[model samples]
Target: MTADPRRSRSARHAQPSAQRAAPAPRKEPITVGRIADAALEVVATEGYDALTIRRVAAVLGTGPSSLYAHIVNKDDIDDLLIGRLYAAIVLPEPDPAAWREQVTGVYTQIRDLYLEYPGVSRAALAMVPTNLETLRVGEGILAILLAGGVEPRTAGWARDALSLYVSAYALEQSLVRQRRRNQDQEWVLGDEELLDRFTALPAERFPQTRRHAAELISGTGHDRFAFALGLLLDNLRPASG
Candidate 1:
């Protein structure tokens, strides 16, 4: 049977319309969460020092003015970034028997996170623990210390010290990694080279360093980190009943 000319023509037109490329996906709306994600991407790729309000806006394909609706400024972005990072840490139940290990694990987790985004610890160092997530981490640490029978004052001070040490450690590692990336490797010497330099120092001016060069230059990977953390925790004597 011969097809109707009108029907054939209509079918031809409908085929092309059905085959047309799909419309472009709608742009996702900007939100505080999206802003935080874009800001973190900036830090993860370009380092925390490279993160800025304009940069995050650019990353999200928007203008700085748009980001202001969600974030107040770069400081605000820092808080958001820190909160996001802290949110990833799993707080342990305060176990009096394992409080020391729990505390170390928490800080180690934070240190690892900071190292993942080079120089991110700089933001943490500058930030006060005002964000809920940041405060939560502090609370978790304090709970563990208190459960271990550490004095309230000592636990408070210890929390501050641990936070400071972790940030400082991560910052130092990030700086060293940055230097190496920039091909400024002279200051990032190998253990043997560092030991040699320590021993080469004037005997009178650096007697202890020269004598203990190997010890000073020791600690592979995070051995020094563990050792220092131990020193801080070991000194805390649980309050006697």
Candidate 2:
């Protein structure tokens, strides 16, 4: 049977619309881990400042409300980020004879790792670590202190101090990095340039600073970090014999 011209035209027009009507395939379910991974990607590509619930949700092809089902809020995401990063570290066993060194080493590792994800350390400033991996790192540090004879009270307080220092330092570095990128600069100012600037200061007015220009401008970050760690450990001596 021959089709009517009007019916044929109507069916031809309807075919394209029908083909487009297939429901969008089901999106993979969002999970806490998936949300955290998307958030980290946001952080990696656009610094921590750019990370937001909407931004991460967009990355996951979902809405912010969907993420709420799996994670609490931005703070929760921050904790997850820290937990994710530290989960990769293989902590050394605590040793009494080497506790100070071990603790310092761990702190250095933590600082380096925190620095890797810009702005993550900012969260570390106020967030008490309740995440499993974060707690594991804290436990390792505390174990070192206890093994070395630090009293429990002192060790607890020291943990707070160390955490504060690492977070502050990492935050500072991340800010500086962000500033450098925004300013379109390359390389941190070299020590010699810093020394020259300091050395050029009027000796009569800033004699102390001028005299110590080399000392003030010297030392790689690691050197300064080791010195600071040493100072902290020295003052933390185990209850004076």
Candidate 3:
């Protein structure tokens, strides 16, 4: 009995083509979480200026297109960076009796988170909340204000004001650290020396500056932050009867 050759040929051809076997896509198996972490690393090591899709992709051993599969763009990455930092902030429950302290505590935690990641704060300047974590932080803040008897408009404004103040403060702190890190190792001046120079300025013309030099440069970052925060909190008054 003869086997049918055409049937055998058709069966062979019908089998899936190995030649057409597309090489499994070179996906780097990255997750949104991993990409977000890599973004933070880039900000921490190189500052926010170096945080780009290309840079993050390189850090992740993948291409920018692969990152797009998980993140949308630079703005999206900014949101993630801010979100990552905010995720560490544990906002306190609103206490009407202690709302001022609670609000301060919440922002203090936020500032610390920013400092932890260094340049991540730079990405937060003027950035609207787009991620869940960031929004959660905002909600916590607003709740504190509302509990404090702040009107809706006042609560909203206070929320924005606090966020701006904290982010701006963090951004300035990061920039100073970055500058110091970039300065010449041999030519560095201590903070006291820097203040002394200010005081040493021509006393004839810069009298106030010379007299108040110590006061002007007084306090650590935390001290100045607490002072400024106090000013804001102490002045927030509810509507008078």
The top-ranked prediction according to TM-score is 1
lDDT of 2: 0.84
Q: How far in Å is the alpha carbon of 65 misplaced in model 1?
A: 0.8
Superposed model 1: Cα runs more than 4 Å off: 1-26
Residues 22-123 of candidate 3: C-alpha lDDT, one tens digit per residue: 678775579888988999999878878888899999999878988888776788889888888788889888888999999989988988888887767767
Error of 3 at 96 (Å): 0.5
Per-model root-mean-square deviation over C-alphas: 4.1, 3.6, 7.3
Report the CA-based lDDT of candidate 3 relative to the real structure.
0.84
Model 2 scores worst on lDDT over the 10 consecutive residues at 13-22
Off by over 4 Å in 3: 1-28, 185-189
Summarize candidate 2's per-residue lDDT along 55-134 as a digit string, tens digits: 99999998899989978788999888888888887788989899988999899898888888888887676887778999
Error of 3 at 126 (Å): 2.0
Q: List the residue pairs that clash in candidate 3.
A: none
List where candidate 2 sits over 4 angstroms from the true fold: 1-24, 184-189, 239-241
